[model samples]
Target: MSPEISVSTNEHKVLGACPHDCPDTCSMVITVRDGIAVKVQGNAEHPATAGALCTKVSRYTERSYHPERMLHPLRRTGPKGSGQFEQVTWDEALSDIAARLQAIAARDPQAIQPYSYAGTMGRVQGEGMAARFFNQLGAARLDRTICASAGAEALTQTLGHKVGMRVEFFAESQLILIWGSNAIASSVHFWRHVQTAKRNGAKVICIDPRRSETAEKCHQHIALLPGTDAALALGLMHELIVNDWLDHDYIARHTLGWDALRTRALEWTPERTAEVCGITVEEVQGLARDYGQSARAGQATAIRMNYGLQRVRGGGNAVRAIACLPALVGAWRQRAGGVLLSSSGYVPVQAAALERPELLAGRTPRTINMSTIGDDLLRPASPEFGPAIEALIVYNSNPVAVAPESAKVVQGFARDDLFTVVLEHFQTDTADYADYVLPATTQLEHWDVHSSYGHTDILLNRPSIAPLGQARSNAQIFRDLAHHMGYTDPVFAESDESLCRTAFGDQVDFDLLLTRGHAPLPVPEAPFADGGFPTPSGKCEFFSARLAARGDDGLPNHVPNFEPAGADPRYPLAMISPPARNFLNSTFVNVQSLRSIEGEPLVEMHASDAAARQIADGDVVRVFNGRGTHECVARVCERARPGVVNGLGIWWRKLGRDGTNVNELTSQRLTDMGRAPTFYDCAVEVVRV
Candidate 1:
């Protein structure tokens, strides 16, 4: 391993963006010396990142030039899951992949599935080129709904658009409600505004099942049972309506179906909701009173909602119900009063053009939701479901560690008939099972365009340094594969620079983006200030006819989740898996520095639960459900609620006790809407190992 050091006068800086799965797509400047990246720091000019980088990204140089990073293509020399491979030239690898893909296409092109997610936020390397290649081959469409899809769709239906309140408006808020999000860990840039809002006399409140780091720092933390967010939100609505605290004028002017929503809210009384949510009736009333009175007093309130509340059975409905709060209080009229669901809608990138979905060759391929990758991998082909997947090309994701039903996913990966290919920078747990592990370039060596979902900044990632070895960006890899497979579509030959230019519409100047590092979209400073929603009725849909047509609840309503009922003796505790502070998914967990900082993968249990199981704080415990089991060190404390436990996200099987990943105990059941994975709606039992 080489240490990153400044070369005095020879060191130069290049502007880019952090290409992680985070909402805060931070603008960055990489320090390069002698064609090697020496350091990574946030671009001071970018408002979202300010000038400081997060703990994980600050060590970008180490990750780029890590000794264990795969630098060349390799073919399997041992059995699957053995992590043994022999170096192969790019020519040999591409030829073999092309031949196999040709064979697969002859029988059924839909048998080829491309697995990916937000591994890199780059416009070209992340999604564009590969999507074009897959579309041309008429491959099965990967439904890419593993995260944010449910919330995005639900909010889109209610608010008519997914764009939330402006990030800059948080400082002007008088009340900040951080719901189901750990801003400190996931969205650090946004957390700065929260801190400033708190300093400016705004009351900060956090609502989460676990007392997370962000929760501990907030002025108030309301710990509720997991999957009960909808119930609590409805209870707040009930209090607001029963007490006549709603903004009837705003509702009449800027919304539709208010009567239906009001009727639904009245069904969940404070006492009933409190009992269901495991909170006191007084607490419920107090929350409604504070939010309602604060709004009526001309004090603006902001709700920062994230994906944590939407990984359950009623995930989409929960988001829709919570998103209606701002409208109920007439929050949209104020700069900082509306709900912030996501900033994704701010950038109008021509994704369909970049992906060239017209290349599907008139074959309406089967769509497979990514959340059910475990089931998809194991299930045999049937007449109803088309052909079984024969070849899986994985890039920008580690499904084995991050996907639900880890045991089943691993079992499917071990199938002898499956031909698996992985493109990665490191030998992740998923890579360990790949038949071909192709080396991939780090962000420093790639060209990409990034648009943040947390902020309205569009940034460019330039090649600060040359490719380290034979490594290639995902875009280049797909281009090479397409050429060898006899596809001469002009779209495959499109340059990364061209893709970046096409990411935004005419509002952006591509030349200026390269020079300035980042540029803000020409959107209104206060979007939705006048209540011109983009819905069918040009108003917020308090009752959505689209949902009703789909046989879903027309009004914002609470639907019960899959938490175990009647205090089942087999699985008594609910488990919530959240992102670790130091790692993004499973990306940085292998870095020695980050691994040391994160210490070990442990199960955090409440003191009472630990005591009942006769397990001490440091005791090794087994967490199991009917799905599967996992073992880890126990951290018994009050951080987690008595009936609930917490397991940090995406630890490799080898790193955990008894070689078990937390996802092993999680089910792959799809949510009622959005076909999202119900990761947080699981029941497990903890016992001494």
Candidate 2:
């Protein structure tokens, strides 16, 4: 393609996609001038993004050209975590890493572990070549279950699929429930659809522990206690059944275990549920009444289910209980009435081709859960546990700031024996502890494909600008490593274009995808309207025998978390750490603009709770528990529940007053069904410092 300049002198436009850890997967149009990227905006041609990018991504040029960006490979010159390194050539770095990994794999394959998450999220850079190399080396397999696994598992058990209502159909809804999600901040593109739905006479309701940005904008906010959403949902079910509001026909024909679910729900009375959830009995009954009326009146109601609810010990069961609500009310019969967990499955990618798991040659490497990184890092080598983690190759994640039990993770990183290799665009909190830090290209300088979890659009990205300095894409780096290691696998030889085309498969046209920014994936008009589920029973399993076989309750019921909701003598305050608006995990926390917009990280508690502790607003406070302690300014408001306190996550350790992060207070305990980390099931007490 020729360089097409705009009316402005020396200005050219290049197409790409935002590669942040977001569900939007927004297509971007970058403005380039004289070999430099000057601006970035959302592609108007894209259906989901619709010409509007989020606040954090609008300043892409600032982050891409930031002075602090890592522009070359470097080897540690001082002690670990000292952020002191000397420059090295790519060949030298790759050859050294390959030789070390080969030596480690010869002794025990499980000795090396590759750590990453949605930091890139692009199909190729996210998993493609890295997967091939790891599988070929028989390194420890990482279970990427840090974020949405538990909620996805619960939704799959109830709906038989993780796919949800088409986001374009949100405007057809008469009532929209934003449950445990602050779409306005996390998924700004989808928030536009909700705004349109509101304009179309949809009543918006937000259910969360804190009054988030979305809750503030919605017509109603149901602030419940943390980890008590299951009790509230079951109470609504009891009202739907006892008050004769349930669709009997829908239950009899399309659902199984109606009697069992009814019996279980009946045990949760509105009063009891209200007490558990810290809401009034009338509020619980009101939600049930409104939902029943909407169903009876043929008005569609949509539930936007987010991952926050499934971050507790009872999180899986909580999701199961909530997902069963739409079926009882016959909401799935309407156009957009069903619960929308995630739209990722709506667009299928050819994963077999991209990952090339055949590289492992039928050798199944030991699987390690990402949530238990701290535990695995600290564990000693043994015959039962395989070899202890000797080499830690980090990318697309900052576990030091984001992982649970952060103090323990730091301790593991401090080990002199651990050989840490980090690929990053900046010297992040985690990179400070690395033995070698390799510079990585920004999204604008990479070629990859992206699919949205909030919409069914598959978008393609092309390199908008040259990679700054000596930075390379993750795929390029891995390919270099494979060549240095003398690996002859054909998978490593595959080009990025070939891999992208392979991921699209024969079903999609690659040329057409490049012409247009995105294309909608083919799917049924009404996924569950005819009541044919993919489950064994060919119907929605209200009482999942699959779950029962796994030693869990078949019926959807409330399960208690590790921390009791009631006030305790030791730790009276419940800690709820959620993502902040200006940053995605630890991604943009280092950016000066975003950091200034977000201000300082602080602890938010109810005014009543603050009074009890004799802590005033803006007072520097120390929040502590058995796990660890952290200090921050206090923010007292009605937004937080009386016994609950909240904090924004993924702040750098250096920025905090006590040199600790929120994850220092989080637990490594797993959820009931999906084994996901129970991050929100934590307790702490805050006092004026």
**How many residue pairs clash (N, CA or C atoms closer than 3 angstroms) in each of the candidate models, in the order given?**
0, 0
Error of 1 at 12 (Å): 0.4
Clashing pairs in 2: none
Worst 10 residues of 1 by lDDT: 1-10
Candidate 2 backbone overlaps, count: 0
Candidate 1: misplaced stretches above 4 Å?
1-9, 565-567
The TM-score, computed over Cα atoms with residue i paired to residue i, of candidate 2 is: 0.98
User: Each candidate's TM vs. the true structure?
Assistant: 0.98, 0.98
lDDT assessment of candidate 2 = 0.86
Q: Give candidate 1's whole-model lDDT.
A: 0.87
Worst 10 residues of 2 by lDDT: 1-10
- Candidate 2 residue runs with Cα over 4 Å from true position: 1-9
Q: Cα lDDT for residue 305, model 2?
A: 84
Q: Give the per-residue lDDT of model 2 (tens digit) for 334-374.
A: 76788887877666788888888888888988888999999
